[model samples]
Target: MDRPVNALSKAIRRRLGPSRLRDVLHGVPLGHPLHPAMAMVSAGCWIASAVLDVTRSDPRASRTLIATGVGMALPTATAGLADWSTLHREQQRVGFVHAIMNVTATGLYTGSLLMRMAGRERTGRALAFTGLGAVSVGAYLGGHMAYRQAAGANHAESVSHLVPLGWHDLCSLKDLPNGRPVRRRLGYIELFVLRLGDGVSVLADGCSHLAGPLHQGRVTVEDGDPCIVCPWHSSVFRISDGSVVHGPATAKQPAFRTRLRQDGVVQVRPAD
Candidate 1:
């Protein structure tokens, strides 16, 4: 499964590449993954159609709903696949099976729609009920992948609540490598600290995309602004205020204001 999944992921990446379409699909503009919201459209239509079927309501309405759901599944699936392509191996495997289930359900619904058009309403209703079951399983798998595996979750810990209101000592100024990023401890949270002579910039160590350690990431200047690229997924963040320049990550990494004391200790507090 890993081998084939990897191959398929590669294909998807190649097709998607880096573009505005990919950014939209990744939900960078929306600040969340688009698939879950898109999925509800199709799911709602199918569920409504099933309810109509059980109550023996207007057959015409049921037919319309089934067709709508079938049509919407294409865009819903495209969004899900775009997100799945950027996930980890375990996540991709689960997403692959989830996609298979959805595809099966879609096929069943398509056949049911055709059957009803051919005057076999009873068989179509039966097939629609079966599709509901398949889609239910797929929904469960999608939830598992999103929740249990923490895929597509914002991994950066919010620091405003944890840290005290006042400035606190971070580490000795001498400890940080000059012009390079390094990890430092502050309270219960970790900090990604970079030094340039007397100046320092601080950001939360966890990558917002997947909690990839930002301290281990490489630094580069983009548009003359110092930026750090997440090693896990290459999310580029401006070090000045931790704003995402490029993503998989839509959420901003928490930034901090830093000052150096005359005694050679660095002090930091949450940027207000």
Candidate 2:
């Protein structure tokens, strides 16, 4: 099951590529993932519909609300499916289950809508309640994916606090070859260090997309500027300032200020 789903997701992502539509679906311009916001809208409408189902005197108003809720769910599912395609295998596995539950809920609500239209009020209400249960379970799984697995989160968000303010010794500068990414440690923090000419650029080793090790990635030039392309997801970050050059990632990698100590040791600190 996971294999087929994984294959389909990868194929979908490959087909998506980089486009205005995909960016809009990703909520890049909005500075967040679009799926959750759309999901909330659909869920709110459904909640209102469920309340009206229980407390309303007129079945017309309840049915109208239910229909509206169902309408909102279409866009919500579209946004979710767009995000789902970009996820890693483990995340995709969980998200696939989440999607299945949501589809189940949607199917149930569709049946409920048909029943209501046919004047089967009690049967419609029963089906709507059952759909609500599916939504609840789906919501739980979605929460787990978001918070527990850190799906759609900036994996490098913690780097700012984790890296100390003052320069800390890492290793000898002579050991770092030009045009190669090296892993260095400043106390407990791991950093991706790259040398180009007289300058050394350092960033948090973790990819912002899914914590892919940036040091393991290939360093390449994009439009005459050095960039690190994450091995896991191909998220590209500028080596100069950690800005995202290309991404499934929306957050910038945490860059560091590098300096050479008098003893020829390389030291680094949090960037301004």
Mind giving the per-residue lDDT tens digits that candidate 1 earns over 62-138?
A: 99999999999998898888888878888999999999999999999999999999989999999999999999999
Evaluate all candidate structures by whole-model CA lDDT and list the values in order.
0.91, 0.84
lDDT of 2 at 103: 91
CA RMSD of each candidate after superposition: 1.8, 2.6
- TM-score, candidate 2, is 0.86
For model 2, the superposed segments whose C-alpha errors exceed 4 Å read 57-61, 221-224, 260-265
For each candidate, how many residue pairs have backbone atoms clashing (under 3 Å)? 0, 0
lDDT of 2: 0.84
TM-scores, all candidates, are: 0.92, 0.86
lDDT of 1 at 239: 96
lDDT of 2 by residue, 160-252 (tens): 687656678878878999888988887777899998876889999989888999999999998899999999877788898898766677788
Error of 2 at 271 (Å): 1.5
